[model samples]
Target chain A: MDTRERLIESTRELLWERGYVGTSPKAIQARSGAGQGSMYHHFHGKPDLALAAISRSAEELRDRAEAAFTSSGTVSERVAAYLRREREALKGCPVGRLTQDPDVMADPDLRAPIEETFAWLTGRLAGLLAEGRTSGELHAGLDPAATATALVAVLQGGYVLARAAGSAEVYAQAVDGALGLLACHARQEPSRPA
Target chain B: MDTRERLIESTRELLWERGYVGTSPKAIQARSGAGQGSMYHHFHGKPDLALAAISRSAEELRDRAEAAFTSSGTVSERVAAYLRREREALKGCPVGRLTQDPDVMADPDLRAPIEETFAWLTGRLAGLLAEGRTSGELHAGLDPAATATALVAVLQGGYVLARAAGSAEVYAQAVDGALGLLACHARQEPSRPA
Candidate 1:
């Protein structure tokens, strides 16, 4: 890969581990095997490099989220596909991880892509829930918007719980609990015959 | 406070913002306003100071959590109260924030106190849920342990979502979504047993 590709790739890795505050231009240079002039020549500075890296990461996350949303399945099936999608549970979400970065958390320019990605993900999820409701797979009373937000929160929070506990098992259990609760809202048939 | 107290307090504040990876002994000395000799005289190194700081933050979080649990209210009431507990939102959870700290996440010593704090919190929340179940205030089917973990996860993830969005409003929406879902389990017994 070229210098720009190498730089963004290394940054995604560094940001995942060191966070925005901890990851520096020097660190990126070292990781990318690129010199000072090479880094600055390719990008203005840290913020510029970070903005590119974040946008790349956001695109990757969006692609994965879209795959989950568009995969062949019922709405409930698709939702489960998204939740049950294989993940490095302990490592957690790379883009979501950026949210905890003090520098990223502070800078609006740096934070926007991460924010928009989640907003779109949850919005798409709400749409999926709408599909479920229309198909009579879910109860009408269930709030799609609220359920979508809770779904994302549970997964994000699951990572915190799992990491703090030093196991991915806890994260899985939490996700399962949320899904189980959602299952209760699956259309409960009354005595009426169609 | 004395030099030692100053050092610990500074470490706590620095750790919350910059995290263990970004925080250095030199930085600690500067922030604490304690000279090298005084800092060394008070503590051995960063590890020593970090342990003290993590433990202190853990105790404070627990005390704060207990206040919400012990407040006069039903289970849902108590849970909502706990969810509504005033938070900086942007600064994030002092203890939960550590999970993202590379240095703290790397060293078992620093991670231990954070782990134990969340463990204690989830356990206390489980007890509250169990109490609610027995008192007919909560759904008997709800798993207290899992629910407790999910509740804590919502708060942690809410901070992440909100911060990423650069708005506490999204965080509040996510929490409201989770709380509203849980509220569905609140007892809805009809009056007049004719």
Candidate 2:
């Protein structure tokens, strides 16, 4: 990859691994194999480079979610697929992890992508749930938007729980619990054989 | 407060505001008015001091949660009360935030309290849920352990979302969503009038 791409990729990895406050420009230079002059020539400073990296991570997160949302299946099934998708639970989320970084959260430019990414995710899930309701896949009592937010929260929170325990099992159990609760809202198929 | 207490309290605050890597011993001294010698006398160093602070935070977190779990109400009502409890959403959870800190997670000593606190919380919630099942207040199909894990995850994730958005409303909405899902599992009383 080119220096610019390499810098952004390295920044993304560093940001994910060490967070904003923990990640330094010198570290980024070391990881990317780019000198101080090259780093400054490519971007204004840490925040500017970080913004580019964050935006990239946000877009990738959305794309990954979209793949699950658009995949062939019932709404509930698709949601399940998204939740059950393989992940590095111990490593935490690339975009979601940024929320814990005080430096990232304090700056509007650094915070925007994280905020927008979640908004888009919750919005997308809500739309899928609304579709489920329309197609009689989910019960009428289900609130699409609220349920969507809860699901997203479960995924994000699952990372925290798993990381805390140093076990991915905690994350899987959390997802199972969410799926079970969601199943409680699924409409029973009248024609299906017992 | 005494020098030791002040040091612990200040460390707690700094750990909450800025993570482990960001919180320096010098900053802790500055915040607590404890000199280097006093700090060293009280604890070995940064990691040692952080352990005490983290343990204190963990205990307080459990205490706060216990209040909700033990509140006088039906199972669903108590759960709702817990979800609706007021909080400093932007600040995030004291224990949960530590999961994001590399230094905290890297050291088993620092990670112990966080892991145990969440384990205790989930276990407590699971016990409450099982009680609900025994009383027939909730459906038999609900898995108490998994559901409890999800509930805790929702809370942790809610903080992440709210902090990212720079709005507590996001946290409130996520809680509302979880509550809505939970209400679906409540057993209907045939004798009660609508």
Candidate 3:
């Protein structure tokens, strides 16, 4: 891979593992085998390089979510796919995880991509939920935006719980319980025999 | 306060602000006004000092959480009190926030207090939930342990959302929404004329 590409990937990996505050430009250079001149030539500095990495990770998460959100299925299926999509649940979301990072949180420039990523996720989920309501697939009582926020909180919080306990079981259970609750609200009965 | 005590308190602050890997001994010494010799005398190293500070934080969180959990009221009221308790929601829970630190997570000794604090919280919440159940205050369908885990996640994850958005509004909404959902199954109806 090119130095630019390698630098971005290395920064992304370091950010995911050590967070923005914990990551350093020298470390990035070492991980990518890209010299300081090459690194600076491609990007201005740590903030600039980090912005690129954060934006890329944000896009990756959105794309991954879209894979499930756009699939041919009920809202429940799509939501379930969205939650259970082969996640490193214990490691947490590459972008959402950055929110806890103090350095990342302090910089609007760095935080924008992270913030927009979640806002976009919740917006997409809310849109799907709105569709579900119109199709009589969800309770009219359910507030799409609020429910979407709650759903995202559950996933993010589930990672905290799972990681604290050093087991993905807690994360899985929460997802299962949430999916079950959503499934029980199914509108149309399957024509197939029970 | 003594320099040793000051050193620890300062570390707790720094750790909360910068996390384990991000914080340095020199920073701690400067913040505490303890010379390098004094700090070394009191702490085996930065890791030792962090363990002490983290354990101290874990205890504080437990004490703080217990205050709300044991307050007088019905299940929803108690849970609400626990959720609505004075929080630097933007600052987040010192103990809970530590879970996001990779160095802390990578160290079992560092992580034990965190795990224990959450374990105690969930266990305590479970007991309260079980009490509610035994008194015919909860739906037969809800699992106390699972529900408790969900509650903790909602708070932890809520912080994530709020901090990312730079607004406590989303966190409050998630808590209120979850409480409303839980109230749906409460033995005593919520907001009835009393």
By DockQ, the best candidate is 2
The TM-score of the first chain in every model comes to 0.94, 0.96, 0.94
- Model 1 interface DockQ: 0.41
Interface RMSD of each: 6.2, 3.7, 4.5
Q: How accurate is candidate 3 locally (lDDT)?
A: 0.81
Best by TM-score: 2
Stretches of candidate 2 above 4 Å error?
A189-194, B189-194
- Looking at model 1, residue B110 earns an lDDT score of 83
**lDDT (Cα, 0-100) at A145 in candidate 1:** 80
**Residue A64 C-alpha lDDT in model 1:** 89
- Candidate 1 per-residue lDDT, tens place, B1-194, comes to 99899999999999888878778999999998999999988888999999999999999999999999999978888888999888988777888878987778888988898889888998999899889889998767777787787778888888888777777877777777677667655567312111
Worst 10 residues of 2 chain A by lDDT: A185-194
- Writing each residue's lDDT as its tens digit, candidate 2 over A5-85 gives 999999999998899999999999999999999999999999999999999999989999999999999999899999999
State the TM-score for model 1: 0.91
lDDT score, candidate 1: 0.83
Clashing pairs in 3: none
- State the fnat of candidate 2 relative to the true structure: 0.73
